[model samples]
Target: MRVLGIDPGSRHTGYGVVDGHGNRLVHVTSGTIAVPGSLPFPERLGVIFARIDALIRQTAPHECAVEDVFMSRNAKSALILGQARGAAVVAGVQAGLPVFEYSALQIKQAVAGFGKADKEQVKQMVRTLLRVTGRLSSHAADALAVAVCHLHSRTSPLCRQVGEQR
Candidate 1:
């Protein structure tokens, strides 16, 4: 199965694609959609939506896995982040791909074997698991981690049973 993972941000939306075959995870592509802060927030969201839509058309992923909104100290920041996430999610839905969401802790646990793993630990594990070489940005790495989490989740017996009920 091919999955697209998204790490949404108002300034930069990270995207990664992973193809899972049996126990192997193959990295297809990973990048960030960066928008300058000069643009209005609504325009930024539009850019994110358009880019994600185009990416879905290009990659044809079977499903999309996204990072869910975590609580922030700043409510305004959280709201903006949620808007960015919504843009990405809407793009996935519009493209007819089933979307899955994982919390930050869930993604960290799946990738690093610890729910409280730090960013560095998750980043290193993602690189090791995906065999990605140098120069992966944090956002991209996080996005890749989300993809790996979904791959692992989908293959687990519990997830299979859950899906069966749906």
Candidate 2:
């Protein structure tokens, strides 16, 4: 199965694609969609939506895995992050892909075997799992972790809880 993973942010949304079969997972592509800070906040969301839409069309992923909004000390920041996540989710749903949401802890644990794994650990594990040699930005690594988490969860009963359809 081909899965697209998204780590959404207002300024830089990261995305990664992976193909998984049985116990094998192969990295396809990963990159960040940078939204200029000068652009209006709403316009940034439009850019995110459009880029994710284009990515779906280009990659043809069978499913999508997205990071869920985690609570932040700043309520406003959390709200904006949620909005960015919503835009990405909408893009996946519009493309008829079953969307699965994973918490940061879930993603980290699945990829690195610890819920509180540091970013460097997560990055290294993602590179190891996908057998990728190129450098991966933190955001792209997190996105790939989300996809790996989904691949791990999809065969279990947790699949029903994580897979959200709109």
Candidate 3:
């Protein structure tokens, strides 16, 4: 399965594509969609949606996975994050790809074997698992982690049972 994973942010949206085959994962592409801070929030959201829509058309991933919103002390920040996620999800669905959502803890645990793992640790684990070398942006790494989490979850017997029950 080829999966496109998203780590959404108002200023910098991250995206990663991975090809999962049995027990192996191969990195396809990863990058950040950097939107200028000067733009209005609404325009930024439009830019995000258009870019993600174009990306999905370009990559043709079979599935899309996104990291769910994390609880934030600032309500405004949380709202912005959720909007960004909404843009990504809409793009995926419009492209006819099945979209999946995973919590930050679930992504961390899948990548780093710990729910509370730090960003650096999760990045390191992502690199090691995908055999990715050289520099990797934190946001891109997090996006790849979400893709990896989906691959793991889909193959898990427990997850399959839970999903079937739903």
In order, the Cα lDDT scores of the candidates are: 0.90, 0.91, 0.88
**Residue 4 Cα positional deviation in candidate 1, in Å, after optimal superposition:** 0.2
Q: For residues 1-166, could you state the per-residue lDDT of candidate 2 as single tens digits?
A: 9999999999999999999998999999998999999999999999999999999999999999999899999999999999999999999998998998888898888999999999999999999999989678989998999899999987766564334453
Best by lDDT: 2
lDDT of 3 by residue, 1-166 (tens): 9999999999999999999999999999898999999999999989989998998888889999898888899999999999989888888888888888888888888889999999999999999999999889999999999889999897565332111243
TM-score for candidate 3: 0.93
Tell how far residue 4 is off in model 3, in angstroms.
0.3
Worst 10-residue lDDT window, candidate 1: 157-166
Of candidate 3, the 10-residue stretch with the lowest lDDT total is 157-166
lDDT for model 3 comes to 0.88
lDDT of 1: 0.90
